[model samples]
Target: MFIELDFESDIPIYMQLVHAIIEGIATRELKPGDELPPVRTLAADLGVNMLTVNKAYQHLKQLGFIQIHRKKGAVINSDEMRQADDEFYERLLTSLRPLAMESICRRLTKNQFLTLCSKIFDEIELKGGKC
Candidate 1:
């Protein structure tokens, strides 16, 4: 719920909103069944366009991260979340490939890269994240 947007960043506002919400869920700041602010309200609160918030919400729903209801608005999905399947694994690899390549180009050792990944996992776990 505490989203901070970097207006000057190269990232698109809608993607940043999506990432922030996903991070909130990961950190347990947004638990199952928690209702998100209405799109118009959140847009006004964040000084962003309602369409931006709507786009992010739609993406979240598509990604199975949240559910949208006409009357109830958006809420964190209460059902048990899906496990990583082949599709997810494929997407994960696609996402990580560039980062891994960049790390290699920067001369980061395999152990160092893995250590960084482990550290991130540890931090997320410490914050009560499920993944």
Candidate 2:
């Protein structure tokens, strides 16, 4: 599995990691029972602190995206475990609302916004962008 991190991004590294894993699941790149890299190993590879990876792992586990095991490490959760979380959607909308409103303020049309979303999703599903 490939995970990308943006060091210059405004979003926190841990949160970005969380989203990256979520996208991995959404793209079907990570199926149930697939083991993830060890937190320390991934952190070292990404040039981030172990704590950041741990935080991301903890968040993913909390959201039912992955299961943490002492002996087997972290693995993707089953599909049934990946049900939509309302709190997650609420947080996502809260984060995007400002940017969406800004686009509206810039006179972006609903069709344009929807088209953009569609195109982006297409690219994600086809080209498999991390989002």
Candidate maximizing TM-score: 1
Candidate 1 per-residue lDDT over residues 1-131, each given as its tens digit:
68999999999999999999888888899999999999999999999999999999999999999999989999999988899999989999999999899999999999999999999988988888883
In angstroms, the error of model 2 at 127 is 5.4
Best by lDDT: 1
Kindly report which residue stretches of model 1 are placed more than 4 angstroms away from their true locations once superposed: none
Worst 10 residues of 2 by lDDT: 122-131
Error of 1 at 52 (Å): 0.9
Candidate 2 versus truth, CA RMSD in Å, comes to: 2.8
Question: What is candidate 2's CA lDDT for residue 28?
Answer: 74
lDDT for 10 (candidate 2):
97
Give the TM-score (vs. native) of candidate 1.
0.94
Candidate 2 residue lDDT tens string, 1-131: 77789999999999999988888876778878899999989999999999999999999998788999999899998557644478879977997799789889999998888789898788678755432
Q: What's the lDDT for candidate 2?
A: 0.85
lDDT of 2 at 65: 83
